[model samples]
Target chain A: MNHKDKQIQSAVQRALGDKGLSRRDFLRLSGGGALLAGAATSGLLYPGTARAVSTNARIVIVGAGAAGLSCATRLNRELEGAQITLIDRREDHYYQPGLTLVATGVWNTAKTLDSNRRYVPSGVNWIHDMVAEYDPDNNRVITDDGRTVEYDYLMVTTGLQVNYDQVEGMSEELIGQRGVGCVYDKPELAERTWRAVDEFVDNGGVGLFTRPRGDIKCAGAPLKVTMLTESRMKERGTRDKAEMHYLPPGASLFSQPDADDFLSKNFPERGIQIHWDHPLTAIDPDAKTATFDTPLGDETLDYDFIHVVPPMSAPDSLRESELAAQEAPFKGWLEVDRHTLQHNRYANVFGAGDINGVPIGKTAASVKSQVPVAVENMIQAIQGRENSASYDGYTSCPLITELGKAILVEFDYDLKMKPSFPVISPYEEHWVPWVMKDRLLLAAYRAMLRGRI
Target chain B: MAFSFVGILAVVLEFFRGWFWLLIPLIVLDLVLLGLFFKRTSGRRRKFSLPFKASIGFGVFTFVMALITLPGITRSSWEMLAGAVDYLSLIGASVGFGVLFAILAFPVMLHMLGIGPKHKPESQATRQSPAPETETGAEAEPSTASQQPQG
Candidate 1:
């Protein structure tokens, strides 16, 4: 054989061998090869080696969540000799996307647990403290421990917090007990939720799933948990024994029109009742009753199992800060331009992730799309130039419909479907999207954290 | 149900369009490698097993493609056998891609081996001619052998 033919023959024989390489070694080799190719072509994996702009400005990022870590990695790579300080007391990084999966008993809690230290790039100042005050006028922030740090540029990415107090008598400790479950934040909480779901599915009962008022992270999460719980009961042949109800705070079930239509029709077909314009007000854990504030009056209902999704808002520090918007609609959130992602009043301040007061896009997919734009705009401002990047509000959600099927719903500010894979239709339930949610998204999320697309 | 070749072709095209940038270069390289392979096996065609070699090449290529795209399957055995639907879908997708790849690659492989498209006989004399039948049969033997299920 010729040289090229020999190489081809040898490679095929070696790959098909039974004992040449272990599974882990094979994965590392192949995954590394793909990442190397991506790095060479897109400069996303190893962006620091590419052309970096020189700057000495002190950049401070306020969170170590998905958006904050992504910003830190991108900024550290694109800017040289810049003092980047990441301020967040969180050492454990939770893969928030997988929380729903864990809550439904599909994934182990360990799969969603990771460390922030793995993604936080070296050469950046890591502060193990939370910001207590945001003083934009003085261009400085005071931490909870009374340490004042001044920055020439500020990137606010403090993700939203869930307020369990809004639902009276409901608390985190009540999860996994008394037929109460909530699939939000913290892998432990998700695991606890799974225990409740497991019990409810085996011994069928009246299950109440709720959605709160205003914007929330992963708006589809509550819906996913409800559907997955129903699916699990169906899988166990206990579906007929259970009565389910979905309570949305508003008339609409989803923000996107097509999805709302599909879900509005889908829920009833599956025998899961829908109660619109019902915002959850209180939950009496001892009495096993819940109250909803409706248009007519207060309505209370007894439940064998209840999912308590609380109203979410910006962190207390940022919401009460001077940098927050002081008007209607987007009040009490970080004041930022929808496109540029820069602070409206403070030129040096920028916001990303859930803290930004944009019309939509509060998911991890939005963080992936927003980090590059925000980093590019910050670099341009550092060079004393106009902002060159604009965020189009791209966000995606793999809406799991059943145990093994999902609809990959992707959209932008216009609420128009923008599917990444043409073969997978955005409107239909398919296994391809379920596979993406179950097996692919977590890796993609990690890549985003590393600023590797 | 009657099979629609055009529909399957469209499905394959839609599925692969995302990887066109990589597919184009790999296709060009395949043509080059086939050229070299054809030259090396021209005189020894009867001695070498073309079906075995082609199957090996295609199987390895499809497997590498799967590994590159779906890394989670190799993370652990739990990922592969987690749920019956998930396990079956992963295997089904890999096999489906292989079938589509074979459909796309067979024509190139045949052409590289000097087996062009079949032509209709011009007349009854030509149709009954032993010379034409022998020539066509000789060229088609390897193609038919390669198309057989290897597993």
Candidate 2:
């Protein structure tokens, strides 16, 4: 190594030494790292049918986020002689899971920031534009730039949209000021959110953490930000100075039965008053007031800080398209079969990632699981065969209870706890899950981009 | 992004205060592991063990990750460090921080202990070897028909 490299390496070693890790701990993690690496490379940890099916079909994918990138990468690998195109206007990719850490001040925004160029595969044609309209009947999409792209098959993975404007008197600009924070959207927003959260935790006042009902990405993030802020208050010796409240849009805080029960009990112990069925309707940032549409009536609460989680749905173009579900329950969401992820009416069209109107799993872990099923099924479609692969609504949310502790809540369609690590309990907070979030989860997310797991 | 000593303490305290039922066992296990580290490292032949090497690698990795994550928190923003939850937080965050600290620092400590990868001279030869031939890269043999007298 060069002198500069050696110096950098030396500085890192010194920093690690300062942190107080001993030789034994290194040995343990070495063993753990080996297992992780082995599991990843062995094709057993997250295995799927990974062979190329030769075809001359043109496949078009919408969006370039986690779901889009993952789907495109896997499709590139699994299909030979196929023209695959990924369409999205975004150039930089943000690791959305790390946004919670960014907002909570556990990690910097860089942990959540990356370039799409790194994840987009070699053979796939990347179109740096967005779809203006979806012509599903004709198997073509018109772009905002006025390009008409025809495809034999289509995959929509556009993710979700956070409607801050839905909340009256609130905009993206209001964050990081007036004790307002929302841990969604861009990395910059999460960073701005930390500023508001920091001021609230330090000064000590009424802090309101709210979550919207319906489907949202990483359902655990709002909870994590609240607990982390509370923990920060406890650490700051300002716990007594602040009154905390959690507004769940529904009767329950989480989807999983066990997790909901745990939170219902845990909140009371933490001195947090739960306001069930109170979904945030509007916010007056100037008055530091929030309006919630509760079961009783429209209640307006004054707050020093409010974590605003906006209701999310498919983008307007897709929601307005014929591709969207036309009925109740999953209205305005991508219309796909819950198990197959294939469009109910259109067999050649598939949905991957958050766009699919599934029961649960709007998180990135769902992307990892859903991508394989979608890709395999897409390949089967290309070969004029039956789509045998099915998705069981697998979703993982590493629900952080505190800064360094989290509950790795992995579940399937039945809401049954599926713990990847058998010893780690899904019901209770554990250090391993926290470490996984902070230290390990991103690597897995990236590997999924390469279709390795 | 400093991953402040205080921020780490908050996590420990939160664990104990939030999940108190699961600390003593973890603490005892960490304590035992620390003892083993000392017991193993005190010997003369301590260089280049997996434990030693992994400690260094993990430490380096953590440092790199922290370098990226630390920008999230500034030194001035550590005012929250003043608060403590219960009596358990005092022991929990402290002990927890201690154990986690040891785990993170062990790799660096191992490196500092002069336990680096010892390279054998033969490994240098491996780098100089020619690229392995792929089926396409292999030269085509002369056709028997072409080698026969021209028609």
Candidate 3:
């Protein structure tokens, strides 16, 4: 046997223990090589060094989120000799989507946070700094620490910035006080919302949840918080004492009609009050009064506890960039072709995740879909080939409608219902969707982000 | 019933050959289902006829394109599964196709059902009428105030 074969056999032997390998077992272990050869023969595997040949091209990826990491890893593998540098301010990469689950005491923040180094590929350089200025004209970006890096190719995955300031007389510090908790604001604060919810239940107080207008990451998250709180309150025998209210800026419970129908019908039965078209405007921590803009005019409601989902917008660096101005249609967001994910003006620039102006819910699952198209087009562009790869804007939202039941809304750019598995209604909360969200999605995110598919 | 039977046949074919031709029957079934959904939900003549047709057409076209390109896509995907590839091409393709279908399908589905932005009564009225010039004058103060931040 060859050296590589010997190594594989030894590894297999260790895994198999004292049991002698049957012919079937041996073939199964080495079947990967046979499949690869079959694929290569069929001209499926693109020929060339698995890495990019452009050694002189310096690629800079902004933000170390799922999209940024996925892009860098792909470029590092495909663009053989190209130098890649990933910039982000945070030392730890938190799976931001898990924050909603964390708010419900389902996941711990520590478990969601991973060392940024784990996601960064070996050959690529990692810069632990945020971008202060993006000058696409000069083909360079300046870091907050005053370091300027020039690049041949740039990929923006800075994601969205949470603006708690948008709410009148509200700041980050005021969160988790006087029953005012926001699960969407900071990853650290997600746990505090749960604490506030628990405290409110103990004190026999009403729990109020509010969703702000505009594009928010994981659009279903606010509802997830409300449902989980209700479920928890029922378990604690406080369902009668604590009235759960969901005040949303939108006219419906969910963007998807089927989901809205399911939630609207089911929640009322569970004694959860949903006030549609009510946007939270102000909060008084001292008096515990929450003010909302209703169609009936401004109404102030008393609440002992509140969970606020703050308004979100595109990152400031991207909003000010030339790419945003050039692509007028997507005004404040990164302007890339909806299909190929290539910048309309700059062929060398690309985007993925929340940074893109695509009219899809900003979630990690959305990033999961965009990452590959962005990588494919970038590789195609580098190799002087036609950028045939396109993105259809697939975004999945794992709406935890209750403690152990979730509704997985998987859709594309057109908002067509696409379930991962055959669902009875697809929009209704079920144990199957919940199990996948709670158990499978995290591993999938980690695997996909690392370019392991 | 015929569409469902064809969909089942397509599924059987897909199981044997792994070609996505199965989606053709499935998509046709979905269109029939959509037709039934509209007929039941709207209880009126279809108002979003163009968008509804476009959604079904787009779904079928995307599925066909996806299936034809499956071999090339699956090759890289299989490599990733075997720990030999790291590009996530297969996952990306699935997601990309899924997203495309969703974006096209949502509006049609919503409009047919008489919910969402398309069916909102006020929005329709606004589309029909040109506001008086005095309305622009009234809105000018807020626009100027918003512009000051940018300047």
Q: Compute the lDDT of residue A276 as modeled in candidate 3.
A: 87
For candidate 3, what is the total of clashing residue pairs?
Answer: 19
**A140-196: candidate 1 lDDT, tens digit per residue:** 999999999999999999999888888888898999899999999899999999999
Taking the tens digit of each residue's C-alpha lDDT, what string does model 2 give over A1-453? 999999997786777688786656767888998976664434432334454687889999999999899898788877778999999999999999899889978789987888999878787899999999999999999999999999999999999899888888889999899889999989999999999999988888899999987888888889889988998888789999999999999889889999989989998999999998999999988899999998889999999999999888899999999999999789999999998899999999999988898899888988988998998898888888898999988888898776656688889989998877665668766555666677667766776675666
Q: What TM-score does the predicted chain A of each candidate obtain versus native chain A?
A: 0.91, 0.89, 0.87
Candidate 1 stretches greater than 4 Å from native: A1-47, B1-92, B95-151
The candidate, 1 or 3, that scores higher on lDDT is 1
lDDT of 3 by residue, B1-151 (tens): 0114322333333233323366555667667766665655452334354555566667667766764554344321221122112224334555578566855475556455432222325544344433344432322222233323231
lDDT tens digits by residue: candidate 2, B40-121: 5552334434455566566555555543443232221222222232223334434544455447556445445533233325
TM-score-sorted candidate list, best first: 1, 2, 3
Candidate 3, A1-453: lDDT as tens digits: 999999998787776665777657877867977875664333221122365456567889999888998888778877767889999978777877788877777787885777778778788898889998888889999998999999988999898888888887677777666677788745688877767777887776777789898778888888888888887776678777887788889778777677778888988888888888899888878888889999999999888898877788788877887877454456788888888888888888999988888777588887877888898888778778899887887777877766666667777777687765552247554554565576556666775566644
Q: What C-alpha RMSD separates each model from the true structure?
A: 12.8, 18.5, 28.4
What is the descending lDDT order? 1, 2, 3
**Candidate that scores best on TM-score:** 1
Q: Which stretches of candidate 3 lie over 4 Å from their true place?
A: A1-49, A52-55, A325-329, A423-425, B1-151
Instruction: List TM-scores for all candidates, in order.
Output: 0.74, 0.70, 0.67
Best-matching candidate per DockQ: 1
Candidate lDDT (C-alpha), each: 0.82, 0.78, 0.71
